[model samples]
Target: MSSFFAAIFLLGLCLANAIDFTTVYEWNKFDFVRPSGVDTSNGQIGQHFHQDQVYFQYMAVFGERLFLSLDSYSGIPATLVWLPTSGSSTVPPKLAPFPSWNLHMKDNCDTIQAAKGMEIDTDGRLWVLDQGSSKCSSKLWIFDLLNNDTTELVHQFPDSVVSHRYFKRELRDMVLDKTPEDYLAYITDSFSDKIVVYSRKMDKSWTVTTPGRKWNSLALSPDGEATQLYLARYFSNELYSVSVSELKNEGGRAAVKLVGEWFNIPCRMLIDSANVLYAAFKYQSYLSKWKNISEPFRDQRFYEVERLDAEQPFTFALDTNGTLWLTERNATGSEKRHKIIKAAVGARSYLFKPSTAMTAPQAYVSGGETSDDMKITQTPTVIVISLLVCCLFLCGSCQCVVNLVRMRRKQTSLRQISKDNREQRSALVPVNL
Candidate 1:
């Protein structure tokens, strides 16, 4: 019996290895398709090009487009770019500037200066942080990926929030505190050690300072107003947390509590809709996850490679398609190549989950769900239930009562299914961590 069980476990591992990380793209070096095949080789067009200088800082997948945020300066041409994910050819596709090439032009106050960090929300919107450089002002750019790549909103950062020394400053990471009532963005500035909070409704941003410098990563819980913001710093073993409500105070004064200590310093972190916290360690090849703050931390070896140093996942993002996409940087030598790998993680990002609790009738029927907004409240649900009860009580004939109950149940099921249709379509099968 024990031998049979061992064989079954081995078979499971074999199956996982087969389906996980079916190499989406393996690029030797990044390239962009120039319009009309124009070669800007000899410092042409005033934007000097070097394929080696540009590197991907962040990536987010929405629908058919895979967006990449690159580290840009005077040497790099575009800070924000994208590549099409749907293609049959095995050749690596070239990166194209997102929105347009004009938006990436240098020194333009309206153009993206340094898109170092980015996040794609559940609403299919791309939120990017343009870390200002060389006199170009810092700004946040949001583009609607679902609606023909429309310009959604642009909120330029003030010197007071990001810093007047924009050239030296860097926005390390970005995360969203998306609730039903409000949409907020929390961005980390490494040079000043502050988290800049931006609000969509007010079109205003505020700054919050913490104890650590070189604040590298930030993760937000999906607990609505009760959400907890996780913080990690470069070369720091201790992790910290602060409530989102505290950070939103008018005075911008909040007490950041130490969550716990880590065995390895986490360089990047992600929290999914399932409340699972996943992290990529600085010097480790494998990613780790924590069920909760108190649960035992486990290292997940989803991707295996011969050289542990070659394939350390630097950044991670979960899409609505139930796939987890991440970028691995092998900055060892001249020949080392960066890779974009993915696995079926069966989870969604924190942005897609319900931030606030809805006190409505949860799926009493098997696959029942709420409306699109999940706006089902307690009072309305109660009133609806009461009306149904009265209808049954008033109906005298058995046939009439049966018919009405069936009709009402069917209607409720349809309403619930449509309610949850937009957000909860990902595969729910749990993979071994």
Candidate 2:
């Protein structure tokens, strides 16, 4: 019994060590090409054609539509391109001028240079943030697809908002309110350390500070009850977040509370139907998923699902099925149309990185049974069987020790009996002689 227990215990330990490394996602790059003789106006151009245009700042997807904003220096012709779900099905989707938005006549691709962030409103109005003129410009362009017109310009940062201070090359991205509201918008200015909120009713006239000014990229929680904001430092690759109640005014003040932080640089972010955050950073071209971010998911928290190193541009949107849509820009410069790759959450490459909350061993260990239950509630039952086997083996090891002791005592008795028999036989033979 003891030996059996010992064997079982050893087996349990070996099984524990035999667990394979956790599964991580691996992504493949899909290339969409331009059909022969197709118009490449708003088409994606790679470094092969324009070596100077190295950066693709922002990209957004609404329904079957896809859009991207290029850098001012990028020699790429069109500022933005619109893509669809079904098409000629052969080459990259054709490109046309992203229909002009508010301030159309005043808006030139030059003034709208370096469009960093974009959002599509409930009415299908395309809102784009132009870091305008490498100087201070607080204008956002709104293109109304419903009316096929440029509706209105939202001035997120006005000279008054800047308080007469010169903030050149400001304004990064814009985050839209998720819950049904009166159309509120949040804009981040990397240089100014502030987020400007604009209301559509006011015609983009008013500007207020946002929760965090240090980083860019904001996401709406799945329930649309709160906002998740990401602040990524360019220098150190530190990514953080702040959560704001979707319904609450920033305490009558524009303030952001920090919540989540990760080690890598998160340059861009998008939210899925479940509210998981997909972060694309400059560290590597691979996309990562921060699954199930908490409300007010603040800075210094978030899990990393998986990442790809291929130099593909990252963009996010949901398909008709509400599955997350991911597109990557090809830098190979091999095709006329910059590739627009599509990936659904079902893709093998899709990953879920639990927040430190999920992966922190110490936190769970310290939390007692409640914490352990919360952590593995969804895990399979095989884990319990494994534990039981380990326990059984440990119990058997004690019985094996007892059986060995009894076997030793029996051997000693046998030896004593044999010695006594031999002495009696010798005495009988001597007396007869």
Candidate 3:
């Protein structure tokens, strides 16, 4: 009996270790190709393209294409582009622009001056925050991705709500309110340490400030309503939250409350529909997850999920396919190149409601109960049959343990998989027609 319990415990440990992210798509550096047939790798006339100048910051998966936001202020060909989902995981695909090549013109008021963080809504609309150049004012750009990438809304921030010192780059991160009453955007303006709130229905903007500056990441709880806005500041382990009700005030006096504080400083944060919170520490090798928001963040509630070669997950996103996608840190001196890593979450993104959470069984769930329940009656013949069944089961217990060990070994060996391992839809064309 003790041996049977030991085997069961070993199987549980194996399942926990199996839920991890492995390297999928990787590149020493990114490549960009414009719609007009201009390749950045070709070294065109008067064009300067440096391999060290460009790096990806944030990403959002809409349907079949994974959109990436390039965080570069100079020498980058395109700041916003995408890669197909059905391509070779080993081969780095040439990134195609989001909508068109013309929209990426630098310092143009009519185009995206600087592409920063972005989020995709359930309606298939891509909401982008553009840190405008010295030649243009900061603005918000939304595109109807479901409708041929048509223009949805373009609004410029007035001087009253923006920081005079860092107006061109103060906007750091933003999260949309999921309440059905009205649409609001809570954006982090780190230059002045303010949370800029914008109302889509009223077309008005306001600002809210918490304790620390350098506000880096923002996540909304999976309640499917504007309950709390989770905020993480750089170089800090304490997480804070503000009520959406108080944030809706144009008066700009929303109260900031400290919710949970742990040992790890979460550089990036994400929430799944199951209400599990993920945190990726800056320059840290391991990633963590918090199961309950109601309880204080302690070692018992927060668990380290994975670790890889001291790999740093700077940016990440949870998709509907039950995958957590992230970008690792890369440097010119380091032998490792920039790579896209993924893990199995077994739950959809927080963008979906909890009741509507979509899930697919993954390696974490593959080793679950695979046998059916048995029943026995009072008959002597039935008792004899049950004894025979129990004798046969006892004989096969060793094989069951062997199969469980083999299942875990199989998951560990094949770390890398080609394509998005979940479900494959028709790949989106790289070029926009």
Candidate 4:
């Protein structure tokens, strides 16, 4: 009987190991690496030589150095950091071969503001997603690195879109949907939980709108064949995907498809050449239940790695090592500490156990993959095979239990013998200290 329990326990652990797990490496406070040089102004490790400002925001690894859109929320000058990578956890105490430049978005702007997302276009032009508001900047600044000018405003969106009340307003982050030609860009309006697609050339005109939220982010594939957008909707703790097809339509509307939820509160999403999607979120929810701030970080915080398991997940550039890169909105430390999260595997679990709270059958459904087909395919034969495996697990568990029981009995008997011997010895001995 005990042996059966032991066998089952062993089998359960083995089965759990069958699934591949992902490891997440995090550098909370630029702990990974540091840039060298002292700005005579503030004397901080990495400061804009021209001025002292806090350079913090989303990062993009281009060459050996990581480029950050220096987002100083308090009207501090916005700049870009080109820090060298030392191949170590801690960054080398030096700047990149070239000095970190404060590519201040000047002209047509009254004050300085923080930038959100960024991208390098097909022609190698730098596209910066500036917050379209007095809150930030009311335009998406495209710096033509080749021309060496920041005064040019490649595209500008109205401030009203970035504000509340519009369908697909601009919050901060922007992505290029450079597919099928003339499809243009997909920008995330975090305030409205919507993604606004715009034309690349001719003033960056608006194209289409999709779902998204504050902490949401996106990326484009290197193949230039598709676009993979990641939305981290905090209210419902849902992660969503919007696709930009390489295929075209007659009306010039890129046949856009909402691929459904990808993960919970996904702060950022990246896709590699192998089609692996790496998602970074504020919190990781394992179930349908909502989570709060007090949740354990080990259980719910940090980023996760997931494979693009569907026919068409999001798209992105594939590096030499086959890694994907993504762009995201401003990830402030406060949000990282307090924001909520959702689960990537929530859809499948919901299908097995229909939630009474769910109003429709479609609630358990996912994008691209339908639950009905999965349900029908899971027949009696599959269940029988599962049962057989479970039985083997039980056998292993029972063996462990039996060993435990025998060991316990042996311990008890030995203690009893020792007690009897002590009693006899005490009777023969005189009282002593």
Candidate 5:
């Protein structure tokens, strides 16, 4: 019985060790050719002819399509292309030139020089963050993806927002708030440690800078009641939060409070619909998450989900279905190591429930559980069954022992009765018979 219980425990431990992390897409190189008969004199013809010079920096997902943006910091033309998630054997088709002008045109509002960060809002509009280049000015481009094959540029940030200061700013990542009453956009400037807030309705912008907080990444809280902005610094692993109302006030610098130290240095982070915060560690090649946003960072649960090599330009995107897609940035002048990896973290509906307070997901590292979530709440069903079987076996063994004792006593009593009967018969018969 003890051996049976030991076997059951071993089986349970083996079952807990199984987890799957899958790689969905990989490529040895990225190549794109200019369409036939395109004019070469304008210089737009050679834009994508030299595919070896291009490298991927950022990515965003909309529906079944994945959008990639090139780094172009080294004189390559910044490019954007979308391909089906079903994996393609060839280079993705480039989005057509903006309707008003050709790609070769200088200072064109339609072109993207360097896109470091982009996000898809709830309204299905894709907001692109262009850091600008020698030819282009720093600007925000909004496109309606639901429109024709050529994504139409619906709106552009005004010159007032993209001023001289913007040119000096190194915009990293952005989050959109499409609330009916307040349409706000929060952008982080890693170089200057500033947060830029823009209002769509008023068409005005404001900048907020803190003395100690050096902003690197920003994520909006999933809670709809309080508008909170969570941001991290360039090299610091600490997380901080501030209210949007305070940040928008032009009166003074908003009060920024430290949420807690994340311990792992984070490069980028995103908040899911469940209000869970997922952060990609800088050069650590692993993704970790905080299950609860409202709770204090120390009290909240953290789990590490995926692990990869220490590669430059690591980035990730979360899809509508709660799947995380990640890849390392391709480096210029280096052998291509292009790959897109994805992990299905179950659907949002299954993972999130409004009634129940969401707890952190369980994760194992090197075959050992890492967080408090791994604590066993109740005995497993298999272990319970094994215990019941052992109890039944013990009961049967006790019953057999009782029966054997009863039989031994019965035989001894019968022997005594036979001796008494023989003695009495001998007395009834003649004395010495």
Candidate 6:
């Protein structure tokens, strides 16, 4: 009976590992025929240049359309393309420029210089981060997907927000907070090592510079009430988190705490309904999942989902139907081909499981009280002291109690020093200690 049960358990584990990630589309070079008489000089290329002049930088899905943004780093025109999601052609037919050609001209106010990253909200609105063309200012553009197969520009960041700083900045990725009372947008400026926050209600924005060099990716915690923001640096394996409430209250250079660390620098991350964080590595070409977000990093909670043989997965998107999509780009920038892959990771329900309560780290403030969410809770020393006092009342052995108290005090002091060192390393600004 014991052997039979063991065999059945092993079979179940094997079946769970059988899920395969399917490659939906791959192209050596993006080949498609444009409309007749379409000029290839300025913004009228018949197709993406056969050489490595064009590269797919980001992707997003809305309804029946699958949208891709082309990188302008190679001097190609900044453009976005959309095709029917149901089509499965080796070379996609009718790949049309998004919005319209009128919006792509240099003199137009709606012209996009370069779009590096994008996000689609729950209301079907597309938010694009324009990295700024040579002649244009960096801005964020929001478009509403209308029912008539067209889009309307709803909002654009003012010139005041983009032109405030004299130094060059590169806005990379964004995450949205759609709480009822607070609708905020957070964007990462990789080049400047800053995080920019925009408040929709107030129509205002602010910037916070972090301690690291390349702060690339951002994700919101699964908890709705206490929505903490998770940030990952590009070249480092460390992951950090900060409270959204604290950021809004204390604006510039707010302190951040180290939450978890991963094996590789994650290029893109997605937090599912179950609070599971899925990280995609750029050069490593493997997908990993951290199951328990509140716990410290451990090999037990981290699982390697799948490995891409040769392709490097960059940007990722989760569709309405719970399908995961990734853009596999040529990491070396030498290969001309790229791909789009999809898989079902079994997250489908409308209701998300409540996230486990996270223990907040101790933070030092200048004068004001520490934020409620940043306050550290009961420590092991408190429990030990309480037990020692109880023994004093019950048995009252003076010599034995003195030795135990001295030993615990030494241990507690050592622990405090270690914690202080960690806190110093995690602060966004230099600490006096």
- Clash count of each predicted structure: 5, 28, 0, 34, 0, 0
Q: Candidate 4 lDDT, tens digit per residue, 1-433?
A: 3555656676665533222111112222232123344332432233333222233345544434344555444433334444432234322232221122223433324322446676655443566665633434456666554564344454556544445223345455555655444436667665553445556555644434432334356644434333445445544445444455521221233323434454454554544322333455443321111121112212122322333222112112221222222222223333221111111221211101122112211111112221122122234674466567877667666678779999999999999999999999989998777
RMSD of 2: 12.6
CA shift of 250, model 3, Å: 1.0
TM-score of each: 0.72, 0.57, 0.74, 0.48, 0.68, 0.69
Judge candidate 3 at residue 123 and give its lDDT. 78
- Highest lDDT: give the candidate number: 1
List the candidate 5 regions with Cα displacement exceeding 4 Å: 1-19, 37-39, 45-54, 88-110, 149-167, 298-313, 329-334, 347-433
- Please tell me which model should have the higher TM-score, number 2 or number 6: 6
- The parts of candidate 2 lying over 4 Å away from their true place are 1-55, 100-111, 134-136, 149-156, 162-167, 178-181, 205-213, 223-230, 233-255, 295-313, 329-338, 346-433
- Lowest-scoring 10 consecutive residues by lDDT in candidate 1? 363-372
For model 4 the TM-score comes to 0.48
Any runs in candidate 3 off by more than 4 Å, and if so which?
1-14, 37-47, 88-90, 164-169, 211-214, 224-226, 299-312, 332-336, 364-433
- Record all residue pairs in model 6 with backbone atoms less than 3 Å apart, i.e. clashing: none
What lDDT score is found at residue 45 in candidate 1?
A: 32
TM-score of 5: 0.68
Candidate 4 local Cα displacement, residue 92, angstroms: 3.7
- After the best TM-score superposition of candidate 1, give how far the Cα of residue 351 lies from its true spot, in angstroms: 1.4
Those runs of model 1 whose alpha carbons end farther than 4 Å from true positions after fitting are: 1-19, 37-48, 211-214, 293-304, 308-313, 354-433
The sequence of per-residue lDDT tens digits that candidate 1 reaches over residues 1-433 is 4534644555455433332353456666777756665444433234356765566768788877788887674567777888765455667778887887667666777777788778887677899988877777788888998898888999988778877675557777899877777788988887766778999889999887665555778888875547888888656866788888877764356678877776777777888766778787766766677655435444444443444354234677777755677777676656656776665555577776543222222211111121122222235675566445544444434457568889999999999998787446554555679
Estimate, for each residue in 197-243, the C-alpha lDDT of model 5 and write its tens digit: 77767766667777767688878876355768888877788888998
Model 3 C-alpha RMSD vs. true structure (Å) is: 20.1
Strongest candidate by TM-score: 3
List candidate 4 segments past 4 Å from native: 1-56, 87-102, 105-112, 132-136, 144-153, 159-170, 180-183, 207-215, 219-230, 243-264, 283-320, 323-433
lDDT of 1 at 255: 75
> All models: lDDT?
0.69, 0.50, 0.67, 0.41, 0.61, 0.61
